[model samples]
Target: MLKDEVLKILLSSGSHVSGQDISNKLGVSRTAVWKAVTALKNDGYDIESVNNKGYLLTKNKSILNEAEIETCMHLYDCKVFPKILYFNSIDSTNTYAKKAADLIPSDFLVVADTQTLGRGRLGRSWSSPSSTGIYMSLCIRPNISLEKASMITLITAMAICDAIEELYNISPLIKWPNDIVINSKKICGILTEMSCDMDGIKYIISGVGINVYDTEFPDDIKDTASSLLLETGTKTDRAKIISSAIYHFYEDLDTFMQTEDMSILKSKYESRLANIGREVMILDPKGEYPATALGIDETGALIVNANGKIKRIISGEVSVRGIYGYT
Candidate 1:
């Protein structure tokens, strides 16, 4: 924890931070500060310590950790996520979040560098190689009904798009209900799970898996899936993206919770929707149908024109896809 505190000071200082200043601020000994810096360096952080100058955290393509993420949260002045729980590797952030749901507070984040058992929507495996992706889950307890909970996934997709657009300067698109894509290739997936009883809603675990640095994919998904590096030809800081996503979620969540519907947020979401104005095939359990995506309505349903007839497809009810291939 002292290392994290030292990291925050170094990051925000933007220059060398004196050991004495860190000790005074954190109410610890200078020896403790020196030890913290050493720990950070051991953890793969690029830190510089000169004879006169204190410590400087030079930017590098290091792995995701709690200190960097918390520093980003502080730099961005984000409020919703007060606590961040990070893991080097895990079975799945979603599974961990759910298991520890009652223990953790609302807006607590669970992030991992790699997932041994990563998952996606419709029972698909998400590729989660080491140092190649961001796997995180946000835990929240909103006082809304179960019916309105599905919209959280859409809101998360929009938040991720906000992060990508701002950080990478790339215009990301939402593939219908729960996917983020660039150049028509998916770079992220979202799975939102809710728990509740007759009383009210308990909590929602919004799991997001983002392909950050991967340049290649499996043979089966090479044609459809992509990463930020593949899309932008540049390496990205995973912590900043995570911080931005959390910030944007709180930004849009206020407007959404006010109405408990997508009416207020539908316009913004539709503008970045990849399925809008496109012909997509809906894979329903009953059967498949071809339709032109009109956009989402106030209730977060996909509005489509099916053979001159209008129909609204609910989230989790069906999978929408481009007629030619995955979007």
Candidate 2:
């Protein structure tokens, strides 16, 4: 109890504390206190000491290791994705999942504390640092079609956001097609990659990255990035959020499969739309267009109000960046 207080005080302030002060309050000898403080320093805490002064915390970064995340798991079905492959460093969770799914059991979860080659939709680079995020991928192989696989992406996005909403009570808006934004900045990014044969399907791997605790974003994305910590002004438990995300994901995926109708998912999706009814610019290989957002249709297609007529846009080289730029 006293050791924790001594460490907490040293961590909370930049100024040096004294060994005498720690011993006086904790009722422990200076040597016993020194051992405890030294132990915390060895555990990656940047504690500095002077001749008289006790310790001063210079920095504390999240060691986004797997033990902490696994400690956060609350799913009653512990067998479901129980084995998490935690990597200190990895190229990409999705790429690794794709390669590993051939032999690994279904529903195996792979989480990386840091990703060197993280990827986003449209081959964009996903910025993932060790400190403020979760980079996890799950391997799933369902007896579904190559064409109907869009539901997997939609359902997964909804599940992740819904779980966050349930746990943190901070609702994030969906940037239709994929991605979740809070305060007009991206908070979560989803990448769904699958290997399917012409006759049937092989496996589907879904990668999810959520920025939970962050002090800053990359300079290139500073204007367009955010984190749960930045949004709520409080530190969040990463394990709790990740467990909640997976649990909600399983529930929503089951419901989506049972219905076999995207209309049901579409309705629930609209309630969390970030670009609905907003002026937008489309960045596609076909150039660009001016359109008003009409929310997504049942097929997970973006409906655009172009020239007062609704155009149902299916798969194309499309990028919906908001014209008004407000989420």
Question: How far out, in Å, is residue 128 in model 2?
Answer: 1.7
lDDT of 1 by residue, 188-267 (tens): 99999878987767999999999999988999889999999988997878998999999999888888988999999999
- Largest lDDT belongs to which candidate? 1
lDDT value for candidate 1? 0.88
| Model 2 per-residue lDDT tens digits across residues 1-327 | 445566655644558888888778778898987887887767677777878656776765454445445545643344355466878789999999999988876577788877999998878898888756889897777777787777687777887888779877888888876788887888888899898998655888889988888779889878888888889887766666777777777776676677654776788888888888888777767777888889887778889998788887665457777865543
Per-candidate local distance difference test: 0.88, 0.76
> With candidate 1 superimposed using the best TM-score fit, by how many Å does residue 187's alpha carbon deviate from the native?
0.3
CA shift of 40, model 2, Å: 11
Backbone clash numbers for all candidates listed: 0, 1
Instruction: Tell me the spans in candidate 2 whose CA falls farther than 4 Å from its real position.
Output: 1-68, 76-82
